[model samples]
Target: MSTTDVSTNDIVGAPVATTVEDVLSRFSGGNREDLIPILQAVQNSTGHLSRESVLAVARHLNLPPSKVYGVATFYNQFRFQPLGKYHIQVCRGTACHVKGSAAVLESLKRILKVEEGQTTKDKLFSLEVVACIGACGLAPVISINGEFHAGVAPDRVAGILNVYRRRAKNG
Candidate 1:
């Protein structure tokens, strides 16, 4: 066995069973063909493909780190960072853009102190810009974890965020 055969706890720097080692253990062999499936499995369990996890996978499969990272970056489905409790997706399609979604997105960034594709420091929110959410009628819309909010305005960003904050605090 290779040095990569170390325990999952040893590999992840955490005792969790969902580490790269745990995922790799479920598959046999180190064939190059297993790359995508391995990535998908790791991401499915971990919510995101962390840098350490990717490197661990490379070692496990005997592939270069660049090969793994190249494949992961080629796919939009892969995320480098873990998502926040509330994943915020802002629609920036043509209709939403015409309806002033850019201003709405700016407000969200300022209020959350996070740029697109980044989670807030408190881990309460993550922001993403999507081409569309299929809510053209509700232009300038954003969705919090798939729950759509329509007709969002720049000034209303604070009130909208406060609602989620209140719920989290109260709960």
Candidate 2:
């Protein structure tokens, strides 16, 4: 696994949540204007924004939790839950849409039994739909932790998921 993959930190405990406090310290005395950067840093450190961390951030910034949530939810860049071991990003950009990526996305959702932006109960996978993956020529694409699967059709999603499932099982 790459060292920089934040998904490696998909740990459940106070330890992971505590990193938010460390990130908040960097923005000590900062105000609401610092909310975005603070959130980004926290997510970078903890891999997501948990309710505990969000409350801490609210306290640190002297703002309401609702305000912090408002900003985080407003932007697509923020994630409120830890990424699963496999982070699946489906492209829904113009080119991807034209190529029927939406069907591929729905296939994944149905098979995974989780909606977009959620991790599976096993914590093995999480789904995200991004505006673009920058592989326009490879429209209808999905990537697992930055490894692209190009020209994906709805039927292929299960096979792709099985590949990862087998890997996890074998290891």
lDDT winner among the candidates? 2
Residues 57-130 of candidate 1 have per-residue lDDT tens digits of 89988989999999998986566777787778888999999999999999999888887767888988878787
Q: How accurate locally is residue 161 in candidate 1, as Cα lDDT from 0 to 100?
A: 89
Which 10-residue span in candidate 1 carries the lowest summed lDDT? 6-15
Quick one: how many clashes does candidate 1 have? 0
**Per-prediction TM-score to the true structure, in the order listed:** 0.77, 0.87
Which portions of model 1 show Cα errors greater than 4 Å? 1-19, 25-34
Compared with the true structure, all predictions reach lDDT values of 0.79, 0.81
lDDT (Cα, tens digit) per residue for candidate 2, span 47-139: 778899889889998899999999899987677777888888888999999999989999999999998878899999988888876899998
Error of 2 at 20 (Å): 1.0
Alpha-carbon lDDT of model 1: 0.79
Poorly placed runs, candidate 2 (over 4 Å):
1-18
